[model samples]
Target: MSDAERQRRIAEAAYHKARERGFQGDRHLDDWLEAERELDRQEPRRP
Candidate 1:
C-alpha cells in the first residue's frame, strides 16, 4: 500500500486502541507506535 494508506490504517488502529483504553491521557503516541508495530508484525515479507 501507499504511504498515505499505511498511515490511515495505523491511525485507525490507534484510534480504536485508545478508545478501548478509555481515552486516557498521553497514550496517543503509544497507541500509534503499538498499532504500527502490530501492523508490521502482521505484514508478509518479500525479501
Candidate 2:
C-alpha cells in the first residue's frame, strides 16, 4: 500500500486499541507503536 494508506491503517488500528481499553490513560504512543508492530508482523513492507 501507499504511504498514506499505511498511515491510515495504523491510525485505525491504534484507535481500535484505545477503544479496547475504554480510552483510559495516555497510551497514544504505545498504542500507535503496537499497532505498527502488529501490522508489520502481519505484512512486512518492502523497501
What is candidate 1's lDDT per residue for 1-47, written digit by digit as tens?
77788899999999999999899899899999999999888874334
**TM-score versus the correct structure, for each prediction:** 0.86, 0.96
Taken over the whole model, the C-alpha lDDT of each candidate is: 0.89, 0.98
Per-candidate clashes, comma-separated: 0, 0
In model 2, the Cα lDDT at residue 36 comes to 99
Tell me the tens digit of each residue's lDDT in model 2 across 1-47. Answer: 89999999999999999999999999999999999999999989989
Error of model 1, residue 27, in angstroms: 0.8
Q: Candidate 2 — which residues are off by over 4 angstroms?
A: none
Against the true structure, whose lDDT is highest?
2
Candidate 2, position 35, lDDT? 97
